[model samples]
Target: MSESVAGREAGSGIPARRLWLATTLILLIFVLLLAAYLLLRKPTEVTVPAPVAAVPAPDPAFATRVRQLEELNRSLEAEIARLGRDPSPLACPPGTARRAEARPPQTPAIA
Candidate 1:
């Protein structure tokens, strides 16, 4: 009975030893290909830009304009600081009350 079973297994399917050998061979080929690719690949190269020549001097007019703009900016900042310190509402100036008193009174609106 054991002989019959062994014979049946042999005829019916591939042997375990043959399957293992075939799997090992395929894996070895893959590993060898990976190793070859790694060894034969070209190294990456980095290129740097050339240094620029001496920069040209800035335009005199541009320097003057920059100075003017800086002065304007400082004046604006000072104005902003002064306004920030004033507690009065911007909608009404200090002389608005005298103007309102001089104007004739208007009749109340009917609801």
Candidate 2:
């Protein structure tokens, strides 16, 4: 063991521990290089996510128009109910004849 240490010393009689340190560092460098090569052998692909479509905003004008038409229908229904109780001839009178004066004149048949 002493002879091996003496052989490992430099001409200036430096400690042989430097050789062991250098050998250990070289082994560590080779191990790191091998690990890096294995990790980079196959490249991994990373993809960015696609953007989502935006939702359409609700239209207040459309809602307002629908409400107006519905209200108009309700008013017409009320008016019809009121007219049913009236004793007017214009409100579909009972047993009415087909009066020619109330209708458009019939056109004569052309040859």
Q: All candidates' lDDT scores? A: 0.88, 0.84
In model 1, which runs have C-alpha deviations exceeding 4 angstroms? 1-36, 39-50, 89-111
Task: Candidate 2: list runs displaced more than 4 Å.
Answer: 1-56, 89-111
lDDT of 2: 0.84
Q: Report the number of the highest-TM-score candidate.
A: 1
Clashes of 2: 0
TM-scores, all models, native as reference: 0.45, 0.32
Residue pairs with colliding backbones in model 1 are: none
Per model, state how many residue pairs clash.
0, 0
